[model samples]
Target: MSFVHFSVLKDECLQFLTENAPSNSYFADLTFGGGGHSFAIMDLDESYKLVGVDQDPDALKNGAKLIAEKQLGERVELLSSNFSKFPKLIKEKDPEIEFQGILMDLGVSSHQFDIPERGFSFKYDAPLDMRMNYEDDTIETAADICNTRDADELEEIFKTYGEERFARRIAEKIVEERPIASTKDLENIIFHCYPRNMRFGKIHPATRCFQALRIAVNEELGVLTEVLPQLVELLKTGGRLVVISFHSLEDRIVKRAFKELGGKDSPFRILTKKPVTPSKNEIAANSRSRSAKLRVIERI
Candidate 1:
């Protein structure tokens, strides 16, 4: 399948990032999944340049192709590092470099969930490999965690990352059914772990556990927390840092970090007192965007 990702809140993000922008400024899209947001920034103005970064090899490859096809090779520079390492990587390239606007659209990209072999969704019966950077052998796959971790540890991961109510039961059942090598295997275990009556709810029983495992496998929350302050520091004065988080945990972290960074004595100010959610029309058009929440902060 082609790399297709519907850029969530494109208008809102662009408004916050580019409105009243400085001349000849640079913008960074830290999670350049499909180059949707990155290319949008460049198309908005010829004077604006973009630095697109992503860890996923597939995304990086697709971004390069898109950049070339759009004749934006000169205006857009695509990097292959994870967003967490973006600060250090960009610093090494040019110590004085700072961005006019920086954006982070957190959570798994639509392409990741759609690819069966990538193992991001319960809908697929593929291997339980949930590493965002599939090339990074150092990161443990979801199968490894399911097959190895103790029930208690697994429970903690599901409970803390997924907010799963049946985490304990599911974790215990997973230990009983060790060697869960595939997504369907893990999904079945989680399904049976739930009460029979509750299994047919609107949301699948395996949703939370799958989400938890993906977050755990990728260390999404920790990376986000670690990178927020660095991104703030990399912002130019009057520049903005905009983030769109899909889950509550991610939103909480972004909210807290923005508050701390935008404190009275700080060199930043919170732009969105409350998060901005998608419009009714937007959610109707793209169901995946329903849960997204956007927040922005500007360096003073």
Candidate 2:
């Protein structure tokens, strides 16, 4: 398809970022998957400077096209690195350039899912390679995890990340059918593990299991736990932090982090008590956004 992909919760995220962002402020697009949100923020204020981060090689290539297309090279900085490392880079780029807005559209992008080679979707049969950073050798692929991790660890991953009710049974079946090498391989395994009647439920029986594997292989939640607070601290005083999470686990982490960062004694004031979700139209257009929750907090 096209390199064009929409960002989830775009309106709410841009509004939160713009409302509190100071004139001539610096902004960081942490999950700069397709640069949709970054371009939106740049549209708001020409004076605002943006630093976009993404480890995905394809996203960086797309970022170049976006920046050039918008003639934003003068106002934008692109970093081909994990967003978790941005704090150090900011300190280096401008020891004094404290950012006024930080937007993290967490989880895999539509671009990732649409690319079958990346193996993020159950719809396609592809290699179980789900690394956002294809260059990172440290990350274990989904197939590797499926074939290698012990039954208990697999169960724990499914429980912690996927929250699957049949985590134990799934793990047992996965171990029983070792050497699973592709999305179809794992999906078929999950299919056989659950009863035939229950397989055709509301959602695919393999959805949660695949999600758990993807999260585990990518170390997604672990990175989020470390990244969110640093994103908060990286913001200038009165700066805004807008995050769009794709699942309950991520939303819970964002919700808890924002609440802890701001109270009577903390350094932030919550802009949104509850998360902002996509509109009906947006959800209809992009099914990936149905679970998105946007939450914002401002540093005090």
Provide TM-scores for the models: 0.99, 0.96
lDDT of 1 by residue, 167-246 (tens): 99999999998989999999999999899999999999999999999999999999999999989999998899999999
Candidate topping TM-score? 1
Candidate 2's residue-wise lDDT over 1-300, tens digit each?
357577888888877888866779889998898888989889998899999999999999888987998899999989998887888887887777777889889888888988889899878999988888887888788888888989999999999999888899989988998888888988888888888889899999999988888889878888888878877878888889888888999898888988888878887899898888889999899887898888888988
Record all residue pairs in model 1 with backbone atoms less than 3 Å apart, i.e. clashing: none
Which portions of model 2 miss their true places by more than 4 Å? none
Superposition TM-score, candidate 2 onto the true structure = 0.96
Please identify model 1 stretches exceeding 4 Å from their true place: none
The lDDT of model 1 is 0.93
